[model samples]
Target chain A: MEKKIRVLVAKPGLDGHDRGAKIVARALRDAGMEVIYTGLHQTAEMVVETAIQEDVDVVGLSLLSGAHMTLFVDVARLIKKKGLDDVLIIGGGIIPEEDISKLHKEGIAGVFGPGTPCEDIIKFIKENVKR
Target chain B: MKDIAKKVLSGDSRAIARLITLAENNDPSANDSMKDIHPHTGKAHVIGITGVMGSGKSTLIYELTRLYRKQGKTVGIIAIDPTSPFSGGALLGDRVRMMELTMDEGVFIRSMGTRGMLGGLASAVYDVVEILDASGKDVVIVETVGVGQAEVDIIKIADTTLVIIVPGLGDSIQTLKAGVMEIADIYVVNKADRAGVEQTVAEVESLVDITCSEKERKTPILSTIAKHGEGVKELIIEIENHEKYLKKTKEFETKRRLRYEAELIEIIRKRLMNFIFDEEQFKDKVELLIDQISKKQIDPHSAAEEILSKILK
Candidate 1:
């Protein structure tokens, strides 16, 4: 059987609101991918460990906590340290357009802010996930 | 089974950690590894611990894990936290409470975010539990992010579910009544050194008495100062007793059967949905339907029907 793409949707930092994360998780699941949602208040280490343990093809981070600059970079660095550069790292949240360049430079494949469609995120992942 | 699976079963921590990461990422190699290790599963006792935020659930799990380790048993801990909705990043801070066990050879701890799942438990948790079981861990403890409805999801995945409560959290019983109280196989009054321990214990007892049937076993409420590791041994005994009860009543087999059934259905649903949506021809149709729905030209129900009919035809 062809394996399903596994995506770990993580909420990093102190942000407690998860309505958007849940929506994206369901959307990814509906799109025929296995989504492992790490509930609220996750650290970079926990996210990296989960990504490793779940062996997900992609790690989608939803950080509305405005700690995106620090949290996202930490996660990206950890993934590389763990030899998971092959795992596509994508993010969404209240990220400002100015930060997108820096995030991309940090090895994040894509960044979706508020109002980005779930389909767009899914499409981006589908195209990028290494089969 | 991949070579990593064999190494993990043999208690190679590095391999186990690497394989867990692979599984978390849903790496294709993970499936091969799991297949190799599947036969070695079913030995570990799976226990799930959950409660509301600030309830000291992590402290309780940390305490409980120590007791298990004292007996020379290997343990696997899965700590589930919440993911941010907007940024999709996670902090996973629960490991802080478990720092003491970091160097313990008998303990392997992995913290998982709820990712985007509303429930405290992640979908891959079941698979991870199985992986830990196959790795020869005598016990696997899953700690959930302490939210209300999401905590209930823990019950479905755990053989023994412990709901931890702290005192001074106004009407803790009332909050429990919302969902978690009913699913708890064992209740822990954690942070017992704090005020309101007696009140919390009394409330739980009364609730248990009112809700538990005469034929159903009484739910034992234990008090623990998890931070100081007090009363942990008694909690372990209670857990073992629950295990024994399940075994003696033949409930163990029934629970396993139900778990397998749920898993099978979930897999089928996922596969069918993927097959329907991933079809190349359906892609453009889906995109067009989404666009129409977004434009308010058509309702979602009708669009879904159109898609289904095309598949049916």
Candidate 2:
């Protein structure tokens, strides 16, 4: 059987804003991927733990709390520290454009800023997922 | 693959998690890993928790897991949710409720999507349970989506099956009908703090009285406000008692044998389906047969016989 791509859509930090996370999760599901959405108030450690436990191919963190650099990097760092180098980490939800490149350097493969198409995120995952 | 199995046998959490995913996705490597890990299994008690939605199955699991942890026992939880048939995707929100357990070193919790499997379980659940067992968990819990009738497949996989019910649900008694009611090794009346607790318990007690034979062990009905940890300690003790009863009566061995029999059949069935459909010539032949059947040129049974004969030949 062909393996379905699995993604973990997480909201890291204290931001109660989960609309973007849910939307992206639904969109990914509609595009034929298995998405596990860890509801709001997830710590960076929690996201990484869930990613490892779920064995997801992608980890998409949605944070509107403006702690993107700290929270996203925290998740990325933990993912690497835990030897999950193959997991494609992505970020979305209210991240400033200036931090996108920095987020990439911190191991986020893709950053879906507001107004970016969900299709783009889906397409990117399909093209970039490691098996 | 051997290394992965070795890690799993050593209770390496990451390896256990990865292998479970492999099993869930039916990855080819999972077969070898499971084979290697199987010898170390059957040590953990498998518990199946099933109930209607809002029965607080997740909360109960969280509370139960905490209790087990307090006793210095490790736990593994597999929470199953429905996958959308249209997209083959699942939200798997059970983890949201049980997320606090994530930080615990002794507890490993995995969320599973039913993936269109009937009986309110993922097809890979049996294997996942084995993996957790081999990884040294003292208790392994399989929580199914709130299912209606005909979701009793959990009984085949669990050593102890817990059917949870909550008070004031109006149709709480309806869940006690035939297939669903008969599978419960233990019946839990959760949300005991709610109104009509006594009424709910009495209804279940009466149903149990009518359904079970006198020769059979009397199924116990226990109540709990799982969210507040009320009566959970007693629930766990009852779980232990049931486990002991199973062992004492040798039902444990019988159940294990039946589980293996079912598992072997499922494995063979999946392998045969994959083998038959994966061959291009056979697939094309089957497609032709499908067209023929659609056109009323051949019956499906006859077409199946024709294919079987070809395979046999």
Candidate 3:
């Protein structure tokens, strides 16, 4: 049987805004991948733990709280720290253009800013999955 | 693969999680590791929780896990959601209700999609339960995809099966007609704060009276506001009491024996079917027979009999 790609769509930080997370999750599902959405108010530790437990090929973090620089980096770094280097990390929501490269340095493979199409995210995951 | 079983026996979280994935994907290599870990299983109490959508099954499991954790019991949770037939994908949102348990080292939570399996469960659930059991969890909770009256397969896997109901969905005459209601070892009327708790409890009580034989244990029904954790302690006590009953009556061993029998039969069935269908030559021959049947030249039964004779020969 072909392996099904599993993605964790997590909302990190105190932000109650999860519409983007849900939208991305649904789009990923429609595109043929299992998506585990961890709803709003998730910590970095929570997201990384969820990623590990779910054995996801991708960890897509969404935060509209403007704490992406801290929250997304923390989650990416923690996932790496837990020896999950193969997990493809991605982030979205209110990210400035300058922080994109910085996030890349922190191991976030992709960053989708506002208005980025969901197809791009889906395609990126399908292309980048490891094992 | 040998080392994977070693790591799983040592309760390595990542190893346990990855092994479960390999099993779910039906990788043939997982069978070796499963054989290695087989003796380490049968220790964890497998609890199955099922209910209709919005009946607070997740919330009740959360509370139950919390109480179990208080007593220092390790837990493994598998929350199943439906896989979409159209896209072959699923949105598993059970983690939304279980995020807090992730931080606990003693708790392992995994979300699963049914992935075209019927009976309100993922196809790999039996293997997942054994994996968790070998990982040293004292308790394993299998929460089925939200179901109506027909998803009664949980009884075959769970040592104890909980059927969660809530007040005000409909009266007993509407929802309690068959299959699922008869399968419960325990019934929980969750969301007891709702308006129809009394009637709901009464309905289940009457049904239990009508269905339970005089020689059998009467299934207990309890009411709970699971969100607020009301009446949960009593619920756990009742579960323990039922466990005691099962052991005392030797039904525990009988249930386990029956489960293993069913599991062995299912494994052989799958392996046999896979072996037969996976050969291209055989499949092509079968397709030819199917074409003949479709053309009304050969009957389906005759074609099957010819195939069976060839296989036997």
Candidate 4:
């Protein structure tokens, strides 16, 4: 059987609210991907480490605590540092429009903010995933 | 390439992870890699933890992993969840319980969806176990999705099988009568802090006594409040004892042989299915036969024989 798109939906930093993360994780799952959810309060290194062990094609970092800039870049850089160039890094949550551009510059493949449809995220992943 | 297999044999986490994916996909290159990995395996002890949903199996696994880490043994965890049949998706939430170990270099956790495989394990789990073993993990744990009756495939994979139960679950023994309890090498009464711990333990002990009273090796029943780490030390001791018993009796070799036989059969079945179905002409022939059968023009048995004859030819 063909390998299903494997995704790690990680909640980074001290934020405890995981409703958004869980919702997106479910959406990705319903879209036919295998989602490994690292529940609340994860560090950047933990996220990267999990992504490596999971061999996921995409790392979906969901943050609502406004630390998306640091946490997102930290995960992205760590993935790169580990020579995981093929893993696509995407971010979602309350990330502001301005930070999306910064995150994009920092190697984030895409960003989905509040109200972005899950299908769009799923489409983005299917199209851009290195596989 | 040989380099991927070499890296995995040398305990490179990246290569280990990547090779698992390749094996899951049934890529031919992974078969070559497995040839290299097979020799380096058989070192780590493989354990299977299974129970009903909400039985705290994940929490127990987290505690067990921590204990092994304290003993200076590297650990690998394969947490399996069921795939949604309708959507072909799965929410593997076991990682939540073991998140504390995520940063520990000595611990590697991989969550897998069953991918619609049968018997409560992912089809790729055999390879994953070998990959982790070859990667130098001292212990590899396979956690099955909260399974109901008859998910005993874990028995084929684990050297030690821990069947987890919890208190206050209403006639826990009656629930265990469903054939799921027979596969336990060790019974763990988790959530022992809850009411009726003694009752549950007694029930399991009586069952074990009744079932194995004549056997030389009796199944030990242990209790644990996995949430607070209470009784986990005793549980670990019991597990290690079981490991020693398996070695002493040479049952470890028997279990490994069973695991390999199951894996070999699964691989051959999958390859045969892919080979027969991948040919466009064969697929079209099957489709035509299905159409005729639906229209009652051809019997299903005849269609099957026709296809069989082609393959035989």
| Tens-digit per-residue lDDT, A26-101, candidate 4 | 9999999999998888888899899989999999998888988888999998888988989999998887777878
Candidate 1 residues B1-313, lDDT tens each? 5678889889776677667666655556677887888888889999989888988888888888888887888899998877656545454557668756655667887766565567677656777887788878999999888776445877667889888888877774484556777788899989898888899898898888787757568989999888788989999999999999999998889888877776666556655666667768787789999999999999999999998898788
| Candidate 3 deviation (Cα RMSD) | 2.0
Mark the 10 consecutive residues where model 1 chain B has the least summed lDDT.
Answer: B84-93
Q: List the residue pairs that clash in candidate 4.
A: none
Candidate 2: C-alpha RMSD to true structure equals 1.7
Error of 3 at B18 (Å): 0.9
Q: Can you tell me the CAPRI class of model 3?
A: high
The TM-score, computed over Cα atoms with residue i paired to residue i, of candidate 4 is: 0.95
Q: Which stretches of candidate 2 lie over 4 Å from their true place?
A: B169-176
lDDT of 4 by residue, B1-313 (tens): 4999999888888898889999987788798999988988899999999999989999999998999989999999999999998998888889889889988989888888887787999988999999999999999999999988789899989999999988776675574575678999999989887888898888888888888989989999988889899889998899999999999997989999999999998888787777667778688888889999999999999998998899888
Better of 2 and 4 by DockQ: 4
How large is the i-RMS for each model, in angstroms? Answer: 8.0, 1.3, 0.7, 1.0
CAPRI-wise, candidate 2 is medium
Task: Give the chain A TM-score for each candidate.
Answer: 0.97, 0.97, 0.97, 0.97
**Model 2, range B1-313, lDDT digits (tens) per residue?**
4999999988888899889988877789788989998888999999999988879999999999999999999999999988888988777788888888888889888888888788888888889999999999999999999887678888889999999988876664575667877789999999998899999998888887877757468889999998899999999999999999999998999999989987887778777887778878699999999999999999999999999998888
lDDT of each: 0.80, 0.88, 0.89, 0.89
Residue range B176-260, candidate 3, lDDT tens digits: 5878888888999999988988988999888988888574799999899999999899999988998889889989998898778
Tell me the tens digit of each residue's lDDT in model 3 across A18-127. Answer: 88888899999999899998888888888888888899999999888889989998998888788897899989999988999999999999999999999999989989
Instruction: Judging by TM-score, tell me the better candidate of 1 and 2.
Output: 2
